[model samples]
Target: MKAGRFEQAQRQHIATLVRLGEGREALAGREIIQRSWRRCVDDYRLDPSRPRPVRVLTHEALVDSREPVDELLYVARAGVDQLFAQVAPMGYVLLLTDRHGVTVDFRGHPDQDAALRRAGLYLGADWDERHAGTCAVGTCIHEARALTCHQREHFDATHIALTCTAAPIHDPQGRPIAVLDISALQSPRGLESQSFGLPLVTLYARMIEDAYFLHRYRDTTILRFDTTRAFVHFNGRGLLAFDPQGRVLAANGEGRALIDAHAQRTPPAPTQVTQLFEAELDDLLALPRCEPDQLRALRLRASGEIRFAALVEPRGVRSRQRDAAATDAVTDIATGATTASHDPVATTSTPDLDRLAGDDPAMQRLLGLARRLCRQPLNVLIRGETGTGKEVLARALHASGDRAEGPFIAVNCAAIPESLIESELFGYLPGAFTGGNPKGMRGLIPQADGGTLFLDEIGDMPLTLQSRLLRVLAEQEVMPLGAERPVKVALRVVTATHRDLAALIAEGRFREDLYYRLNGAELVLPPLRERADRRYLIQRLFAALAAEQDGAVQLRADALHALLDAPWPGNVRQLKSALAFALATREGETVTVHDLPESCRAGLVSAPPLASTSATSEAARVRRESDDALADPEGLALARTLAQASWNVSQVARQLGISRPTLYRRMRRHGLIPPNRREALRG
Candidate 1:
């Protein structure tokens, strides 16, 4: 129908319903739209004929407001891209909004960018009920569910021309973090015309939600199940992660349904693994992964209903069974320090740097330097691999500094969109641009005043903004996008990146002056493979994690050996990921070689079939290294003699006709940890 005809029909219909005291049921819209219409008429007092213009945040303000949802934006990137690819062909535009109903991320045809922006469908658009009344984003957020607000259903006259379908993307804790919306400037008026919109938006929303849940609970045991075996592995819907004691950590919508059904409740209450399953926790842990035959016998505790189950294990920690006595020990494993029995995990205000690196001279030296510089306002540059704990070091620096009382603001330069990065770091004035907010907003840089601004992945920053950042670093003040004057800020700047800025400078991609400004004090972190204190650090990391999980995690000797031998190309980050995977999958309290990830286990597997070029070469290198160890007959004989003598250094040194230091040096060269240290840790 034409706009003029549609408007006449809608107004007449609403007027007739209002006269009959049934304005809500008079339309084909859902209850959500009816409620919104009532609110528009009653509370907001909006005129049906007079529609308000859409409100948008100034670019700088938008960036600052979106910082909390930046990770969600990053996580939604792939899903949004896939969603757009599926719907853009049909003239649909997708907008992802923060919980406040502000469009933080948008995907649409470039040719329609101007039209979309003009229609308030672009980034920085705020679709909250007060802003964009009765629309999909606003109504979905208010309703906290999926729904379609078709044309003529919208309370705002301006938006009645658009059809929007929206679904809420929830966090692991079940709170809506953002809304995924698909809207069209023009679409058929019939309700059946956009029937596919709801399912499409909900499907992608679930996908994004599942991605978030998996990432958040990678260290926990994930139980995935469905009526059919095939869907268990492929579908993200029926998924749940549990703690060691079987407490529910997280669950997807489908898994929640299964859980609710088992409990015989409309909405499931808090549940534990023991409460839901007939089998013992130990038996469940021992169950094979993704095996249809094994899953056939699995039954729910409440109704004895059969379901297929697949377990996803954490890859990082080695799993081993604890003896009755060890299991009953009072020591806290999570923090690697003894605490009262009230809680297994203890919270700390300060970073536990000691547990992060155990007795490594290089790390200790860096920590000492960092501590000294923390008292001073130095711009520290931490250079390390992506997973090498650069941010942790930055946090440590913040906690150690005098500015620890102030807020610690962190910005991932690479995670933010190019057009918005500046405004995110700086503030903006009201009316700075088209569709901007009536009231001005403060940026992140000013928000970090009297605190610390940790700029992560700074190397990814564009050269265009380098000069602006340099000015901030030198003058300690920020100029808002359209402000006439600069505001002074007293804060320390710390930056970290995996990329080499010197190389970037050589390519003319990074500013040399900016590099020098941020490089006031440089701390280089060593990769996990090169660190000599691997055994202690590994134990510490697992112990801390075990405590946090409210359980005990131990490493079998073989598992420990595999961890020590694996070339961790991704450094500490990779190691943590592997450990988390192993912990989730391990059958018992102790992680064995079989419990580790395939990449980590491959090195431990003797004469295993080559799967890839890298695996083949790694096997060959291992064999050659083992041959070299075998070739050292004297060293092997000495080691055997030491083992026989119960690792008595003096006895072994005397038996081998060498000085004690020489024996120690030889043991170190052969990659042998001192038996005393190993035994003490094992105990």
Candidate 2:
């Protein structure tokens, strides 16, 4: 600005402060600013005539000041970047300040860095009300609300040329923890020029606050609701955290404001869920299972307003049939060991620990060991080949334990990129650079608090991170990247891999110490072909698959025999997929030998040799019955012909003296499918 114009603006700012101080009026601007200006002169004993230079901390002091706000910076970056993208084009710079009013995170035009620094809008700048006088962040911190400090509203003469709007970011307890501000070095003279600024700042501030709230309390039960049912799941405006027994623990700003304004004047304003909503704790918990795919309806006790609500069950708070099984397992553990030895096939069967196997002696013994191991928090190493259901076993182990109610986060070490795995597994320092996923610091390791961390394919994890994993296991704490301090976490670790770690260690590819740390107890899973109880397992699996189908399908004797003869190289996963395919393709209500997928067998599907004169006579009898004059009255005759030929379209088409396409067309006309195989390809 020109010297003469700058002097004139400073004189105008001082005159406005003097008029507001003497009149004690709300007319100058907003009541919030009027209050801040009064406090600046009377409470802080600051002279409006004197202009204070912007206070920017030295490099070392800036680093020290940033440490405590690191986590907030990490969680708020996404929302900040998103809002900055929208407003940066409008000549505004976004600043996120710590609760103490020091700028910790910043985004602005790189070309104008020097001007922003000189104006004290850069990182490490302090904007405390006592230091920077009445400014957006400083005044917002003191008022604990949102306001626009445009031009002459600023108490400092040096700042009369700038316009800044800011909102307070409060924690779950309603304490202002940070401030979000957007400022421009120059703006239009009227306050209406900043009409868009305060509202957008307030909206994103709430978003950032809610995101950090969820991140901080991710392991706990959170109840979110909205006045409209349609928006409950996607944009619930209220967030409340409660214990398993329905006792209110903490609430976000929206929740607190709603409760305080609408709840009953008496009865201490709801210390329990039943107080706020007219429903018992059990009824509320049941809502999740009652409408697992839909938002539940809740009525407020104060206003009877219907709320569409969603409950996030962080643990197994709701009762399930699995709970009955878990109770049995816990009881067994209390009494005695459930046969963790090879000779005892006579151990007690538990719903928690005994359901994975079906009469295999080796598996029975291993499950017995698993039952004993799960009774306490112990690290376990599961060794099995690919597709051998290692993850399922890991889940079963987690379910059987006391920690079953807690989270079970499964991480496939091989799937995540090496650059990202470190941050994802162990978290990273606040403001740390992450290339792959911008929000990588919302890491998996910290989320496993009070739960299980299942590391699948552990053999593929990078060597450098292995040491950090070992340290976390040993000390029960993890140090994030560039972090000066460690965070405490309680978790049960389970590692599984098909690769032999012993061999890897011999080749120096795996850590010996980490191996021992992971292997407090080791369990091996037998391949499907090697299990003595294969027949029983197959029957059990087929029955379960049948239950899931629209119509129950019968497993014919020949189908069972064929399944028994096949080499199940893919183990249980493959077996289940094959059975499911059979159910999907079965022609009638029965699963026949030919209904199974061709890929399930080692070689291509081929028809067996013709039985004898008896079978031939029967085929001829069926064909004779279906003469061209009277086309098999019921389509059953056509179905019979197809079945006799092992459902092979080529073989059946030859017997009928028709091309495969014609046969397929006739079959489609009769609604008699040949187990999904296109007979035309056989020709």
Candidate 3:
């Protein structure tokens, strides 16, 4: 216990490690510790006998060093308090340090504050791996993972008695920004007692990372997913942010792993979405929402290997206001008419648009071009994939154009039957057909007189109807099917389609002259997957849908992850269905994963049932299960899972059947937290 004795023990240990040399694989420690020990000996050449003095920065330097991360400091304050609160009862001192391992913040019980300070667990203490050898704060930053440096596993003699558990907090771009560490001057000899330390610390660390990333890239497209839906919110590695062009802008640790696996590389480089998968981003964006069981195999472009992953889109515009003017928006395509407003309709308010646009350079440019083009009377052709909001963009253009006061009528060419296509555009006079109405009805073209006509899916229009539509556009007049003369009608023409009109022309399916007539001023709408503003759109839709029910409904963290991971082939239309399903199924205020559709629940991440085995083998299974059981605190997680199974441990155990005894033991261990009625009776 004395300093002299500790020094002697460290020297003997170092000499033992040196004698083992390359055979250090036989050492008694975790791989992380063994690796750190090798680095101490071979790289740093730290003297085991000479204990280095703990370095604490001066007050002025510490304050200055933290200035650049003022926002981060503010964001982490709550997490710091929460982590400290969780570990304080266990007699642990919490030290939060910057990337370089200089303690920027510290929390400890009043009675033990002095002892912690003397142990260099106070603010400003520098515990970087090089300076403090193999300790938690320093080694965690070096490894970029959650770890525990048990007593004697530390490389320095003076630190041999202290046990430290730490987890790294990375910035949006996956660089370590800070480290959350819990340490004690002395602790139990066995590591098992402190098993909850790393998990608890890592959980809080990820909570902080998620908060920081959401705040940092709040306006960008943040894609969060996992191989299975289980534990995604707790797993920071599956979160990623991308720009409008499908370039990966940022990723957390797990996200990097998913990217690497799919890319067939160690750590994938900053690459476009296209380079990583054989499917072009646009093509993938076009496919229907694939269920977890049937997830399209994402082919690695480089190795030609196939992998499956669930993707979530966390960006989009808020649901548009559905007044009479904007009635029948895109979702009404089943009936054929996707209408628009006569008022200077706001798709999303200017402020909301600005907030949604944020710093996205691509969106800013798009918005700028749209604003300018709206002022002109050009026959605007909006090109985009189906469900990419061509109608919405068309409405926005009409609202901003000189014809803002005129009516805006949207017609889905694809939704109209061929028999009615001609009469639908050019109204027929009385008795034009055997079943004709006693009085002729005004066609959609004349209905748009003195306003705008939005032709949605214009490519799907019949070839004969295209010629009639072109004549109306070229002559600025509409001729009723049975009328004796043409009636002049003034209106702006806006056409949108997902099809490549040029290809249609070559196939003799569409007219080239109609294409040229509609292509006066062109704007292409990016699919929801490609937009960086996806997050805003999602939240906005949820907010609007919740309002429709006159109740507050929101996606819980996991439910949001489920929504985000869905590949919305129908784009906004598909997302609306999922949100509507959640609203209908959700029990209370929060929409958890259970409320999500069956497609979202498919392939949920769950541990397999424990195998039936001999009594002797069962014990080893229990031991192995114990390794992961303590990775999360037993009280809350255990209680929730128990409640889900209606307190059937046998069922729960079978469901998470890693080991039989492990589940029972854990339930018994945390019995008081959620004391089962039957278990209490047995007790």
The true-versus-predicted C-alpha distance at residue 366 of model 1, in Å, is 19
What lDDT would each prediction earn against the true structure? Answer: 0.72, 0.74, 0.68
CA displacement after TM-score superposition, residue 354 of candidate 2 (Å): 33
Highest TM-score: give the candidate number: 1
Q: Which runs in model 1 stand beyond 4 Å of their true positions?
A: 1-25, 262-270, 290-297, 315-683
Ranking of candidates on TM-score, top first:
1, 2, 3
lDDT of 1 by residue, 1-683 (tens): 68688678667645643542344444443667777777766776666656677898998888776777755665566788899999999999999999989998888888988878777998899999865778899989888889998877777766767889999998887788999999998886676899999999999999999887776675678887777666766672577888888888878787777777876643365477767767788877776665445453478777777777777775334222221133333222212211122211112122334335656778866665665477667899999987788877887777666687776777888887888788778868998766556686778789888888888899999888999999988888899989999999998999999998999999999999999889999999988777888887677656655554456667899988888888877676556555654554355578787555545654544455554676455444433332233234444445445655767889878987999999887865543344455333223
If scored against the real structure, what TM-score would every candidate get?
A: 0.53, 0.48, 0.41
Worst 10 residues of 3 by lDDT: 341-350
Number of the top candidate by lDDT?
Answer: 2
| Cα TM-score of candidate 3 | 0.41
**Residue-level lDDT tens digits of model 2 in 1-683:** 67799899798778777776676445543678777777888899888878887898888887677666555666686799899999999999999998889997789999999888878889889999996998999999998889988887788888888899999998877788999999998886688978999899999999999887775665568888878776666567888888888887888886896678565554467788778888888888766522334878898888778887887665222223334335455444323211122211111222334447767888876775676577467799999987676876887888767687777777888888898788777777656773544443645777777878889899999999899899999999987776788889999999899998999999999999999999999999988878877787677667555644443568898788877877777677667656755565457789886666544444432444334576454433322222221222335456656765658889989998999999977866554545443333222
Q: Which stretches of candidate 2 lie over 4 Å from their true place?
A: 1-3, 15-29, 262-264, 289-293, 315-683
